[model samples]
Target chain A: MLAIETKQLSKSFWKNKVVDNIDLQVEKGEILGFLGRNGAGKSTFINMLTGIIQPSSGSYALLGVQGPNDSIKKKIGVMPDYSSLYGSMTAINHLHYLADVSGKPVSRQHCMEVLKLVGLEEHANKKAGKFSFGMKKKLAIAQAIIHDPQLIFLDEPTSGLDAESVIHIHLLIQQLHQQGKTIFMTSHNLDEVEKICSRIAIMKDGRIKKSGTMDELRAYYQSTITVTIKHSPIRPADLSTMQQWLEQAGTQLDIKENHFTIQVESEQKIAEIIRALGTYKIDIYRVDVEEPSLEEIFLEE
Target chain B: MLAICKREFIQSFKGIKSIIIIAIFLLTAYYSADFSDLLLSLSDDFTSEEKQIIHTVGISFLIMFLGMLFVMGLSHDIVNREMHERTIRFLVTRTSRTSIIVGKFLGIALFWFVCLLTSFVIISIFVHRFDLITLFQSASLAIYYSAFTVLLSVLIPKPSITMFLSIVIGIAFPILNGWVSLTSNVWVSWLKYLFPFYYVEEQNYSFLVVLLLAGVMVGIALLVFRRREC
Candidate 1:
């Protein structure tokens, strides 16, 4: 079964159409990254799917359940972007209370374990108000996963975190993904999205402009691959001969000192270039191929 | 529902605001009890039996007004604080909005009930007699005001505005009661019913009436809150 499906899903605030008609779907066990610019209705769309706000039009279903089913809430978890932990409650107490409300069988031991997983076991007795920003975010994650949900929505899970905290959250996401839990994440961190997301959908003006894997998106854009070659030291006359040979083959190349950077359409083209160079009796040092970065592809669209 | 109620009840007492409010209420109740005795002594127009009812009525008025003042202070921010702080999003996603409204109302009602009981015990010691009817009346009045304040908390966007508006309306209606009585017009006379204290007046006290009013206010709050977005 699909983890989430929406058909013409739309939400509006009075005359302002925050999220226009949108059709989206996510397969089970897939880590789908949702990306959009500010004021592009990402939060509104998530809110509608989570049942925090009713859609003005269209429909959506989560895990085969339709429209804010209470029984299905147990199977889904959410870490909202702007949520605040209770100031006076300790971390353990907060988790325990949330676990009970979310229909989980909460125990002090279990709560401590969840806190430990978030690197907050030692601070279990500390009030949430005393926690730092990174700690509060960890608490939010712990609350989201306390029920061991089949699916989780993490809105900006690594936003505003230090490098270490970001790495910790990324590791946690990897662990959850390895356990076969589906994750729907929204983030401005393209680098992290590229690292963890199996599929991605980019939204613009309340509409998805593109959705696919990184390779698929690159293929759709028909971006060229960059091939870097390090060749043995050669005389200036040898470089001229090599440039004429490349012109005869109609290959695009840029030479800088001892290295050559070639833009090729395919691996076959790269092999052809190497074979052509080999015929010139030029000794080769090494070759490295680079694919287009997600950031580049994202900005291109 | 029980989980939400339990959380709210426990959290209500965890803050210094609750302690401060309780202290202020206790001090006010103690002073009012002694003030009633002194006022009754100056009024020789009443016999000893009438003096007891008069003194009891004086304290009852104190409870009705002071209890509402406490409600306005304590409950104005109950719902809006969660919204302003963005914590309601957590509860709304996991539980029904109706449960949040009802649970929070019950929790605050519980807090106000305990405060009313403590105030009653202190006043009883100074008055030298336990007036069961007065205690019940004051307690119900306190609960009713709390319910109204809860409803207002859901309606208003800010706590300070809710408190200001509630106090203005609370004081305005009673002062308008005289204007409402001077006119013989049926509609104007009916305006007297608008005052929250009208139901808690000397001859108008009834446990059932107070409960019904509180229930209606809470029911309306639930319906309104269920439709509100986080």
Candidate 2:
């Protein structure tokens, strides 16, 4: 079963559409990274799927359950913002409370185990209000996964976090994913998502403009690859010769004295260009090929 | 639902809200036992038997009118405060919105029940009588006001606005209801029925009707809260 499926999902406030016609699908165990610029309706869309707000129109289903209820909610966990925690409640108390609220009363040992996974076991007795920002975030994560849900929606799971907290959360997420839990995450940290997620979706102005694997999105955006060459300084004569040979390739070569950057359509083209350059007898130090990154894909116009 | 109810019930006493309510109820019960003698000597509105009713459980009657105002103070922010703080999102995701409304209402009602039972027990010990009728009356009035405040909080999800209005309704409703009940003019007399004192003032067990009013308010609160954007 798909973890989540939405059809023409939209929400409006005073007729101002925020999440507009967002049709999204997530397969059962793959992490789908949701990326967007600010005000891209990412949070609003997640809110609708989590049942925090009813969609102004359209429909959605989670884990084969249509619409939201205790059953769907019991299976899906939403990582809430740190501000949503009650100040007076301790970390352990929050876990027990949220677990019971979901109609799954976990054992004390289980609650502590989740807390330990989030690196908050020592602070279990501390009030949430007394926690630092990073600690509060971990607490939020602990609460979200207290019931060991099948699907987890982590909205900005590591934003505003310290480096260590970010890594901890990422590892926890990876651990969850390894355990066959499907994760839908939104983050400003593109590198983290690129490193962790198996699939990605980019949203803008309430619409998803792109959705695919890294290679798939890169192919959709641009097939060009960057090849960096550490070669001996090129004479103006060699530069002209290279440009003329590349004219038929429909691209230009960038030469910065000893090093140069070239865009090629395919690995075959790179190999052809390498042989062409070697024929000139120029001493090439090394070559590095770089694929398009998630950042570049997200910034695609 | 029961989990949410239990949390709210325990959390209610974690702050000064429940403490203030309990102290007020207990202090009034302590003073009403003595002050009834002084008031009974000066009052002419009641028969000798009517004076006896006041003497035994005047604290319940007093709370029936004014305790609701205190209840407004206690639960006026229960629903909207969560929305204002963005905590309702955490709740609605875990449980149904109806569970939030009904659970919180049940929690606050439990507090009132405990407070009233303790105070009435004190009154009964002092006067050597347990007024089950007046206890129910006081409880019904509390339920009416608590449910109304929860409904109001859901209607106006802004805490600052509801806090202002709760105090206004708390003070104004009782005074207006009391005045309207005293005035026999047919046109304005119906206005007294709009408040709790009208039912409370009647000897025909009308306070039980306040429970019906509370139930309706809770039903409406559930509907309003279910559609609200968390």
Top lDDT hit: 2
RMSD of each: 3.8, 2.5
Can you write out model 2's per-residue Cα lDDT over A1-301, one digit (the tens) per residue?
8989999999998878999998899999999999999999999999989998889999999998899666688888888643567888899988998899888899989999999999999999999889988888888888899999999999998987889888888899999999999999998899998999999999999899989998888877555678888887666777887768865553557767787777877778878877887888777899998888888777763
Can you write out model 1's per-residue Cα lDDT over A1-301, one digit (the tens) per residue? 9999999998878798888889999999999998888887888888888878889999999999997676778888899987698988899988888877787768999999989888899999999999998899999999998888999999888888899889989999989999999999999999999999999988877888899987787777654678888887667777788787666544467888878887766667778878877877767889998877878777865
DockQ of 1: 0.65
Clash pairs detected, candidate 1:
none
- DockQ (model 2, Cα): 0.68
DockQ of each: 0.65, 0.68
Enumerate residue pairs that collide in model 2: none
Please report the candidate that would top TM-score against the real structure: 2
- Of candidate 2 chain B, the 10-residue stretch with the lowest lDDT total is B55-64
Off by over 4 Å in 1: A14-16, A230-259, A271-285, B11-17, B20-59, B119-136, B173-185, B200-207
Candidate 1 local lDDT, B133-168, one digit each (tens): 666777777778778888998998786788687677
